[model samples]
Target: MTAHQNGTISAEVSDFLLNCFVRSPSWQLWLSLPLSLLLLLAMGANTTLLITIRLEASLHEPMYYLLSIISLLDLVVCLTVIPKVLAIFWFDLKSISFFACFLQMYIMNCFLSMESGTFMIMAYDRYVAICHPLRYPSIITDQFVAKAVIFILARNGLLTVPIPILSSQLHYCRGNVIENCICANMSVSRISCNDITINRLYQFACGWTLLGSDLILIFFSYTFILRAVLRLKAQGAVAKALSTCGSHFILILFFSTILLVFVLTLVAKKKVSPDVPVLLNVLHHVVPAALNPIVYGVRTQEIKQGIQRLLKKGW
Candidate 1:
């Protein structure tokens, strides 16, 4: 072959090989559509429930008010991440720009942290209701609940700022393929060329500190609640008290378990199937968001009745 022809053929071959290597799996893209639809339905249901409660004057109690706030947060969480995720999956766009990716990571962390804080606050609210029935009104006043909600938003929102800022400083080399569905902190961290010792340290410190604090507070609250329940002379009173706290306790355990598993799984170096990790990622976010509305709405008679009434009115 002539030298010019040989050179042109070699260049063409290289371009083709590069494109082949860069292509992502089509199945992953297909999966995102149905998942996005599911999330959309869940968000819609949650919003409807929140609106129903808000419109009804009788449902304006502190507990329901806090729940409405949680539903708002859940809607934000779902809306913020799912659309972009669906786009990425459907378009087969494996790579995200640094800034966009950072934003996604930040918002996800913010909402997740907010959810955790809300759960802890809910536990405290329940504790007061069950353990200090006489002073429940005084202890968990409307003003106190408002302040708690504000604090939950402020504290968790600020906590996530550092993660994205710190992560943005790290350099990523050519091999930046993410294994999971979203651009999660750990997954992005794995692609960095610079030493991630600080990142890893920060994760461990933050993860355990937040988790430990929440767990301790929840445990203490429930302990007092249990003690108070035991002292109740009437079986019906005991049952009612236990029922009120039962769903929240189960949700707390569920959140703690999945979070612990996700963090631990990120620490490992072994190759995991992308599907498994992606499914877990969906569960980690969706379950907690969807669970709050379902559990509270189902378990609380006032909320259920309010929703039913609203529905009957064509709301």
Candidate 2:
């Protein structure tokens, strides 16, 4: 990444190189073992949850439906990130075609936003069920879930389209070496010789706006839910009331905490190894995907029984 005195060699990049770990090849290969384990767990847990949800007639309710969507999104996110990461870590493949880089960038942006939106809606679901238990059935009907699915799709799909589109317009003549494991938007844009003000501003706006609004609404939803729980008559009544969303709240807590840690690690990068952020970024995708289904399984009675029944039936 040394500068040429002439400053004219940056626009020639036809393919981009990823700065996936540059340690010893053997070191990277050894690191892949744990990463591979995480990918397998994510795929297995989510797929099992999805299948069980589909097979269990009793789980046809809206709550399990939304949970199934979560499992599906987690599976998609895990696949979108991990296989290429494994290729880079294990096989030392770093070069990504220009088109492929932009495509991956688009998926990363759009899907992550959609998943965040999904979490927000899930919080609203809990809020309604807790605050207005009598109307839960009518309010969270199949049609309502369908509308939510459409909103999640339309919101992120529209906002994130510009990210990769604008990125693809950049002139990457300087170099292709992305200083990160994945085809992150900034990682690729920073290599371009062209002015990246538009790209940077758009991404910053898109990410913060989408995630910010979702987090805010989710916060208020849970706040009301907590208020409702505290007003119950007896201690047993309070616990019973909380059980309606106890599982969702627990998973959401874990999800948000890990995500916050990842953001913190980025801001404090000077205190850690140069490689630390990249490692955290890579783990951020897979670890959550792997953890979601497992946590849900433990906390949810119906899903637990569903999983047990599946095992007994040897499916």
Candidate 3:
């Protein structure tokens, strides 16, 4: 029962079979344990960070608000893709309905973009706090955080909506087997029978436009922050500024390095093993989610103290 019948596209695909790691079935068992732990760690850590920020009066500032936004995005990304991945690994349930697959695609795209945008915004927060101490309170406020939230939501939501919609419009006469754990845009689009030039171009353009711009801005933000820190004559001031930004710097490096490697390998896909990008793509979801709060909790003294207070109260 092919969707293409009599040399014409006739029927619609009801579901997609996710061919996740089909090249090595035995690896599923080996991968399942760590993946499960990572998922649990991500869910628990992000939840705890969000709850701590909400309860701690001292953490109600603009910077912590932005951190909470990032945690929320990570939580959404984990929930959107990881459970189904674990299902495929543990239970061999690899089928996804058409609508469900597209919904997953949309969430992954939207939330990932939001996460990147939030990082850029957080860099700006650091930039202002370091570069212009007198203006930090006036410039970065609760209202600013609210407006940034709106901007991230609207920018990513509007742009990402078209991706899934355009992908769904393509005729899937070839087959409905997406060869990845999650319904990535290219994975789903590559299976379409129709000409997908528009889809490919739009995805490439939209993705780089969002991510590239954010990375460039973050770079400049840190550049200015570095200059300001170097200018400070006080030794204690220099150390404090760098310490404040070290956690963010580490998180950003991890986030962007993995993303850049994945994109490069995917673009030059002929040069690399097919599983490399797929493996990186899957890891990108959980690794960052699991590490983000841990990085913050360990590096940011205020966050560590807040968590300690939370634990003490709980006990």
Q: Score every model by TM-score.
A: 0.84, 0.93, 0.96
Model 3 residue 121 CA deviation in Å: 0.6
Number of backbone clashes in candidate 2: 6
Each model's lDDT:
0.71, 0.83, 0.90
Q: Show pairs that collide, candidate 3.
A: none
Report clash pairs, candidate 1. none
Query: What tens digits encode model 3's per-residue C-alpha lDDT throughout 1-315?
Result: 253446754447889989988776666778789889999999999899999999999999999999999998898898999899999987889999999999999999889989999999999999999999899999999999999999989999999999999998988877678989889998999988878899889998888888889999999999999999999998699999999999999989878888989989988999887878988898899999999999999998888999999999992
By lDDT, the better pick of 2 and 3 is 3
Worst 10 residues of 1 by lDDT: 11-20
- Cα lDDT tens digits, model 2, 1-315, are 234688756564567778776643454676699889999998999999999999999889888888888888788778888898888876778888888888888887888778788888899999988899899988999999999999999989999999999988887777678988898888788877889999989987997899889999989998999999899887598888788777777767766777787778778978876676677777878887888899889888889999999999998
lDDT (tens digit, per residue) of candidate 1 on 92-179: 4455666677787888888777777887888999998987789998988889988998887787777667887877777654244565
Q: Report the CA-based lDDT of candidate 1 relative to the real structure.
A: 0.71
| TM-score between model 1 and native | 0.84
Best candidate (score: lDDT): 3
- Winning candidate number (TM-score): 3
